[model samples]
Target: MRAVLQRVSEASVTINGKLHSEIQDGLLVLLGITHNDTDEDIEYLVGKITNMRIFSDEAGLMNKSVADVQGSILVVSQFTLHAATKKGNRPSFIAAARPDQAIPLYEKFLFRLESTGTVAVKAGVFGADMKVRLLNDGPVTIVLDSKDKF
Candidate 1:
């Protein structure tokens, strides 16, 4: 499992010209999954993202977590995050989990994030062609990988 977290003032996901999900003053997370990913990955990321202090406080210091600031979250499934581009011009998606294996984990990740109670969480439909829009806040972005913990 992996995630690219972007702090945003606003974000939304649209499918077929219909808005699917949106949030304000929160983080927009693009999540990727692998076949080996488990519930532990979900647990780890949920904890880290909710507690991450990327938001600034009254002192102008980045001292506030999403929980502290009561911010929302918009999560989008992005298997392309795992694309392997080493060999040639065309990126290989062999490293990414197939939809059968990824969908369940993706849903679980979204559920876990929403359970954090830090903010009002929304999500883009899995396996859908989505158009995402965001107003990045501070342009603060972070990448996380479950494989790197060791």
Candidate 2:
């Protein structure tokens, strides 16, 4: 599993000109699931995301976690995170989990995240063609890959 976490002042997702979900003063998380991802991966990432100290404190230092600030999350599934481009000009998605295997895990991840009562979570339609818009806060973005935690 991989996630690109962008702290945003506001964020929304639209599908077919209809707004699906939106949030304010939160994080926009672009999540990717690979074939080998498991429940442990979900546990690790969700825990990290909720507790990540990206938000700022009153002293102007980045010391507050999402949990601390009572922020929201706009989670979106992005299978392209695992794209492989080693051999050719075109990127290959062979490392990404197929929809059959990925959807269940993705849903489980959302459920797990919602269990953390500190956040107000919103999500984009899985596997849909989504248009996401956001005003990035602090221009702060972080990339996390479960496979690279060592």
Candidate 3:
């Protein structure tokens, strides 16, 4: 599992021109899953995402986690994150997990995240063409890959 975390003041997802979900003062998570991803990957990402200290504190230092700020989270599945482009101009999605294998992990991620009870969570429709909009807070963004940790 891999995730791109963007700290945002506000974010929303729209599908077919209809708003699906939205959040305020949170992270817009663009998640990608691979064939080998397991529950362990989900666990690791969730732990880090919820606890990572990226938000600023009153002292103007980056010391507060999303939970500390009582922010929400907006997750969106993005298979394209794993696109491979070394060989040619067209990116190859061979690294991205197929729906048969990825959907379960995707749902697990959301469930695991919500279980934390530390912040509100929302998600875009899996596999749908989603339009996402956000006002990036501090323009802070971080990328994490579960494969890197273990």
Best by lDDT: 3
**Which model is ahead, 1 or 3, in terms of TM-score?**
3
**lDDT of the structure predicted as candidate 2:** 0.95
lDDT (C-alpha) at residue 75 in model 1: 93
Q: Model 1, 92: alpha-carbon shift in Å?
A: 0.3
Q: Write down the TM-score of every candidate.
A: 0.97, 0.98, 0.98
Q: Please give the lDDT score at residue 90 for candidate 2.
A: 95
User: Which residue ranges in model 1 land beyond 4 Å of their true spot?
Assistant: none
- In candidate 2, what are the lDDT values of residues 1-150, reduced to their tens digit? 999999999999999999999999989999999999999999999988999999999998999998789899999999999999889799999999999999999999999999978798999989999999999999999999888889
Q: How does residue 61 of candidate 1 score in lDDT?
A: 92
- Which segments of candidate 3 are over 4 A away from where they belong? none
Error of 2 at 140 (Å): 0.5
Q: Residue by residue across 1-150, what tens digits does model 1's lDDT show? A: 999999999999999999999999989999999879999999998888898899999998999998788889999999999999989899999989999999999888888887766678899999999999999999899999988887
Q: For candidate 3, write residues 1-150 as lDDT tens digits.
A: 999999999999999999999999999999999989999999999999999999999999999999999999999999999999999799999999999999999999999999999999999989999999999998899999999994
Q: In model 2, state the lDDT of residue 135.
A: 98
Model with the higher lDDT, candidate 1 or 2 = 2
